[model samples]
Target: MTALGELQRLRASRGGPPRKRENKAAFLFLLPWFAGLLLITAGPIAVSLVLGFTDYNLIQPPEFNGLDNFNRMLSDERLHSALRVTFTYVLVSVPLQLACALGLALLLDRGLRGLSFYRSAFYLPSLLGSSVAIAVLWQQIFGAEGMVNQVLGLIGVQGRGWISDPSTALSTLIVLNVWTFGAPMVIFLAGLRQIPVMYYEAAAVDGANRWTQFRKITVPLLSPIIFFNLVLQVIHAFQSFTQAFVVSGGSGGPSDSTLFYTLYLYQRGFNNFDMGYASALAWLLLVIIAGFTAVNFWAAKRWVFYDD
Candidate 1:
């Protein structure tokens, strides 16, 4: 008999093929994941979408009021200020942070001694950057009688309250964001190691300088990594909440200068008890993030390179 006919005969001799039993077991194993998806993630998202169209305080039943929250956003001066602050933070900090990461990665890639220690030390900031403790520490460092002013005092210069100043409060948060460069630095270091040394050697033999080799070989090969970091950092910067919230004391205060979109959403939802408006704001932030990510992907085609 042919192999297929023999197999069919064996299966018929048995009750049936064992594939059904295996499939059942696999489904059983995946049940918890499916349950969590429906209960934890998907359920909240569905409810939030419904809540966005209604006006419901925590105390009252939802009253359907389509587009009012959105319309209010158009004329909300504070919301506009928050948008501007957020955009500025993303634009200014992401590039600076990436630059710092790339510089440090380059330094570390040169076969430095105590490489592990240095890498760990540098990466620690990223782990702690968003923590409330770090934010509070940052506040102390920039306060009127803080370390910054103390140092300036020794230098015969005056220093003001950096975090408390409306003009500079946002800048302090931006500096905090930039300080969390360790994560990207590690990624860049990995990307640097992946580059084949032969290409650099070939350029060197051709009398190319370090800058030339970097411009022609390193950049082209590393563009993909750079783009990856850029997209991730931009998204991360937009979603940043803890640093701003903790530093601003959950008020986004000093004339709303440090008001992040997420902070405003939190104020509306929890502090003000305006759940419906907060849901709308949450969806809006999602749209904004999605739009920026889409733009990054679209723009990446012109800059990002690959081996193939």
Candidate 2:
């Protein structure tokens, strides 16, 4: 028989096409994921969108308020402060963190002894950095009579409460953010390993120095990795709440110097029971992060290099 006739005979013998059975199996495997997307993610997102336009204090029915919550953001001084602090934190910490990561990645790429140990040790911070315990430990470390002050005193220098000073509190938080550079460092190391050693050898044959090789070969090749890390780190920084909440004692205090945008949203939602306004703030943050990510993607056309 012809192939089509044989296939039809096989299908008839099986009572249906095999594809139908395969599709049903695939769909069955994916059903749980689809359910989760609808119930856990899409459902709450849709509800939050609706809540953004209503006044709901969790104690009463939600009353539609139109654009009042968004309008209120225009004159909300604390909200503005939160925006400024968040922007400052993202801007200062990301570059410093990436620089530190890249530097360490370069050092580790040289086939150092016990490289796995070093990588694991470096990666531990990124894993624990956002945890409540780490934030609490950070708070203690920067306290007036904490380890930092004790070390300073050993040098005959008096150390004030770093987390209590409005001018310095944010800086301390920025330092903490930068210290979690392990994630990007691991990514950078992987990217570095993928680079062909022949490129460096070729550059050396042309009398190029180490800086020239790095500038001409390493950077262009690794630009995509750098851009990837940048986008992820920026998004992560924007959503940061645990560290600021814990370090600031859940208040964003010290004159609101460390008031991250998400922390303020938490304060409004749970603390003041202003769920409506908090929902609006959450949407606004969504817009802000989307805008920044879009900008980065648009800008990437000029810099990010693909092997293809």
Candidate 3:
């Protein structure tokens, strides 16, 4: 029976038409992703784009008002203030974060004792940075009678509320942004380790000092990694939310100094019940970030280098 079945199967295989090489496995794997892309991402994006031109506040039916939202945003005082604060935060925080990250990475890359322990310790903050608990901790640390003021009291230097004083509130958030540089520090460390020892040795043989080697070889080779970190950090800084959200008590107060763009969108959509305006704001932010990323890539041609 087995022999007869095998003979029949062989005959069937020989007589059958050539099978189509369908990519069933690849199609199956992509099915769930495609569904998610359509439902979660693409669907909402389309809805938001439509809402950007309407006057829907989630309670009333949407009424088409082409260009009105954009024009209103142009004349909006609160949006301008939010934009100023957001830009200030991005400009100050991103570069300082990258600089601090690079510095720490260089320090850690020097074959320190218990390097793993130090690495984990440094990375702990990045993990906790977005947590409400950490934001609350930051609030306490920068509050009127918080630890910073206590330290200041010991030194007899008058201390205002770090999170309440408009002048210091934004700067405190910038410091918070810089303090979470550990993730970038780890990336920089990995990039540093990828540098071949031969390059340094060859430079040394030619009488190149450490600074000279770093300038000529280390920096140039690491330029790609630096550029990657810079772009990522800038985007993250621009979209910062939790720290300011918690510190400002969800009101973006202290005279709106910490009113980040995202926070403002939340204020409009949720608090003020203006979903259409918030959607428009969100689209504008998306465009701003896209423009910034595009400009960075354009400028990167001059500064960012690739190894041959």
Best by lDDT: 2
- lDDT, model 1: 0.89
lDDT of 3 by residue, 64-88 (tens): 9999999999899889989999999
Q: Over the stretch 28-110, how does candidate 2's per-residue lDDT look in tens digits?
A: 99999989988998887888999999999998999999999999999999999999999999999999999999999998996
Clashing residue pairs in candidate 3 (N, C-alpha, C atoms within 3 angstroms): none
lDDT of 1 by residue, 1-308 (tens): 22323543576685656543577788799999889989998887888888998999978799999989889899989889889999999999999999999989988986789999999999999999999999999999999999989999999999999988999999888899999999999999988998988999999999999999889998888887898889889999999999888888889988999999888888999998999988988888988998998898788779877565
Candidate 2 off by > 4 Å: 1-23
lDDT minimum window of 10 residues, candidate 2: 1-10
Error at 108, model 3, angstroms: 1.5
* C-alpha root-mean-square deviation, candidate 2: 8.6
Candidate 3's C-alpha runs over 4 A off are 1-22
Deviation from native of the Cα of residue 73 in model 1, angstroms: 0.9
TM-score of every prediction relative to native: 0.90, 0.90, 0.91
- Ordered by lDDT, highest first, the candidates read 2, 1, 3
- Evaluate residue 222 in candidate 3 and report its C-alpha lDDT on the 0 to 100 scale: 86
Please identify model 1 stretches exceeding 4 Å from their true place: 1-23
